[model samples]
Target: MLLRLLLLICAPLCEPTELFLKPSPSQTIEGNSMTLTCEIQPRLQTSKAQLQFCFFKDNGALKSGWNSSPELRILAMWTKDSGSYWCEAKTAKATTTIRSRRLWIQVQRVPVSDVSLETQPPGGHVTEGKKLVLVCSVAKGTGNITFLWYKGAMGLKLGTKTKHALTAEFEILTARENDTEQYYCAANNGFGLSLSGLVSITVRIPVSRPVLTLRTTGAQAVVGDMVELHCEAQRGSPPVLYQFYLKDVTLGSSWASSTGGASFNLSLTAERSGNYSCEASNGLEAQHSEAVPLIITVPTENRRDLLTSGVIEGLLGILGPTTFVLLFCYCLKRKIGRRSARESLRSTSSPLPQDSTYLNSPTPVPLQPVYGNVNTLSGDDIYSLVYSTQLEQESPAEPPRTLSKDKVSLPIYSKLKKITVIDMDYDDAV
Candidate 1:
């Protein structure tokens, strides 16, 4: 009996006996209302129990007020009503209980057939022979959706599909310039139809290789000669402007006729002799011509004649006296050289006779009359002595020495003898 009493008391006090409501894991949105219903389960007798319900968010915040009603009403549901929600209940026995099951609310927007279009390799223009991809997609919708692609003003459909989103690709493996067009996309469901914004794509064709032909009025251009250069592109489009360049600098420009050719006239000076090239450009593209060198040769003789008759003549007039002075100096140098040569010969081979007036008389006179003994004699003394000897021989006062022919040679031989005599008296005095 005591054991049964202890069991009854212990059971009621053991981990508060609870009863609560369990909501379904998912709830859907339809029309303007959303209903959230919960199922109640009790661990004890709920017949006598009064239950109160409370709703809580997944973040542990209370979302609705406490009540006994199992269903919560959301009027005019929107995307903000979508979240995790749960219920709590308290019994009259003071036994409180919490439900473990979670609810996920989802608000479904009305389906629409409106679609938007996008393209890859995005640009307003593309090159010829290039591949293009166009994608069309509905922003919000349910059920099957259809898509269509059109090109140009005629609204010709290039492709079609039956899906919520569709993608189409167009390839012109070898596209020409004429392949330019406007494009758009369309989407349709059983409910409604929608069209995408229009787009324009232009396919560009590359410029052709330019043919450069040099045109000149004359075969040869002389320096300081005026000439014209004509560059033509026979296959190109026009209002084409031709730019004439020498060594890559724009010298001048000319406008071509509708035939796509142009000419520029330039005076051929010395500075214009180099690689000459031209470029032709429309608004689309520009092409350069192959370099053609223009060589201008001027005759040296003609230039020299012009120089001499012009500025050079005036220059020569001012410098003529200086030139003459230089020539006169050169002639004087030649005359001085000849005079020096003659002086050298006279000094070496025939010496000038000494002036006798500057000579001292011989010491103590000669002791004996030594013929050819005269050592001190001026030029005048020698001349006078020689004249006196010649006069004495011519005079009739003295007879000439007579001897045989063999003897006659003796006096001449004696006169020719060079005698070196020493005087003892002059030596002793020294």
Candidate 2:
């Protein structure tokens, strides 16, 4: 009984020594809470021991100093928080310090969002034979992410990448005409996939010197004949505008939307017979073609034959109508003459009218004098003679009134006198 009492007294003096870190729900996702505890073995019964706890990650202290609480709570966990973690326990006076074994915590991340696709130069436009790059990125995603590049259609995969980064890129060593198409990308983190909007890529090529060709309907180009001017560029973009030049003056322009060239019809004339050239452009620098000389030949014999044939056809068209009209007029005249002869014979045999209405004679009427305004001067002359009716009835008893200076200076002439003198100059006087 004395030995048992001694053992109990010794147990009261003993202190706890083991230390460990315990985490609830070790694996967690982002935006979730987790609790971590610093545990001690052999709970203190009678000893006056005060303990302090601290948390660490990858050997880095989580707090500035030791805390009185033995539990550490993480309000929101993230992928970056995943690492080796350990806890330390000590007394207020630091009489003893104990460290627990390191522990690893894995924090998952949310699904991908805000997926976008961009280009290196930022316009998605690249010149032929140059390098082009396509970049795909996400605003929020973690863990191993898989990026896919597509061209034209979704099923046609251009490339793929799997890495632990937020962004990825695909390169085209040499851009070509076939590379001008729509492109897009997709990002996945083994949880869900997100697709980006379609991006259009344009590959431009500088216009090449065009080749101008002339095609004639006949063996030789002749005056007043239609000739075709064909201009084509061996390598260039579609919707190319081709302009035809005569010597150095612009004739006309033609647009071509396909690989083949454009054509402009020209009517051969004496002035149009000269050096011809063409140019091609598609919103870039224009390219000119070599000048081609042309000479028009005139055929006199062919022209005379054409004129004779045309005159003969015109006569034939009018001959039928003229003959039909002449025949109808002659037949109608003959029928009217026969009817008139019969009517005259019947009238001679019939009795005459006894009424004297046909013997009446008409009376003759006197002519009246005419009064009019006469203009003697020619060639847009404003001066003319104005005859007033008031002067037409003048009393013979009254002498002829003389004209005043103002009356003569004016352009009005109301009285006309008959002169008996034989001087011809007086008749022409104004």
Candidate 3:
């Protein structure tokens, strides 16, 4: 009974030691070694006493019965190794036992990935003075992400956004000339960073009011001349198509891929003279220019044919009068020939012709004009009488037996440049 009382009293006399665990680094990379140290408070160096250490993780024992030195070393660490740890300190004499507060360790991992960029409206094209929405995203990634947008190489940073979502977007309130270029984005997490591929952007501009121009080498436009109809805009996108029209009819079309202007070549003709207009389009809205006059003047070379025709007409006018004069002279010659023949027939029938004074006397029969005009006898009538039987009976050999001086015949003749005129006088029988 005295030994039990002594043991109870001594059990209360031994002091309990404090224990703690210390990790070399609070955080470590995966596949890397980490050291954990178990230490006792008020370190004991006396030779009379023996002590042991134990390590624990997440309320479970990891290592036990460490002798002399109070330390536990880990070779490598993985994701599962992350947890709360502590250490236990005790005396070998079964006198006291103690534990330490928990120590928390964290592992870092993951980086941004699959960075890309796109635009709204889906056409990959847009008009000037319009809005453009740029959409950026990541196909796969973890942790908080920071997205940054940039223009072409060595370009300005458009904007940035910080979020945990897999996607983000930014809108360009109004697109400007500088907006037409290549663009890209970057996704960054604390672990790493990734850059996206380049995306091309085409900003369409409405063709400004077109200006129609006529290009020619002559001071005055004329037929058969080489003419060029050019259409251009003050500011517009390339690959523009230009159409030329004359009097609202399409003349030709041309295209320009590198500039804001296009032109059409044409061989001018008199029939092509009229108002001309031009239109410009770049796969957007078409812009038309005001009509400009293109009056074709007459060329001096074409007037040769007209002058030749006038000369031929003058020659015909002169020939028409000469033909009429020749016809009159021919008729006179025939009348004089008929008169000479009748006079010869009279001289043959009569042995002695009477004095020619009767040729100058008034005729016994009064002559009256007939055929076409009642005033005078026409040339045709005289020619018909010469071929008819009336002339044969009238000039018969037995008509007048007495050779009266008053009934004698008279003949007058004159020579012209190319013709002869004659006058025959005959009196009516009384």
Q: Which prediction has the highest lDDT against the true structure?
A: 2
lDDT tens per residue, model 1, 317-421: 888888999999999997797666545434543222221111123332332322232242232121110100101122245344322233211112112212223
lDDT of 1: 0.58
lDDT of model 2, residue 350: 24
Tens-digit per-residue lDDT, 155-222, candidate 3: 57999998777788889988887788988888886666688888888888877888999988698788
The true-versus-predicted C-alpha distance at residue 92 of model 2, in Å, is 8.3
Best by TM-score: 2
Q: Which segments of model 1 are wrong by more than 4 Å?
A: 1-123, 129-131, 135-144, 161-175, 218-243, 253-263, 280-287, 296-430
**Which clashing pairs does model 3 show?**
363-427, 363-428, 364-427, 364-428, 365-428
In angstroms, the error of model 3 at 372 is: 30
The candidates, ranked best first by TM-score, are 2, 3, 1
Clashes of each: 1, 0, 5
Per-residue CA lDDT of candidate 2, range 312-410, in tens? Answer: 889879897998999999999978976665554444432221211111124322222222223232232222232221122223575544323233222
Would you list the rank order by lDDT, best first? 2, 3, 1
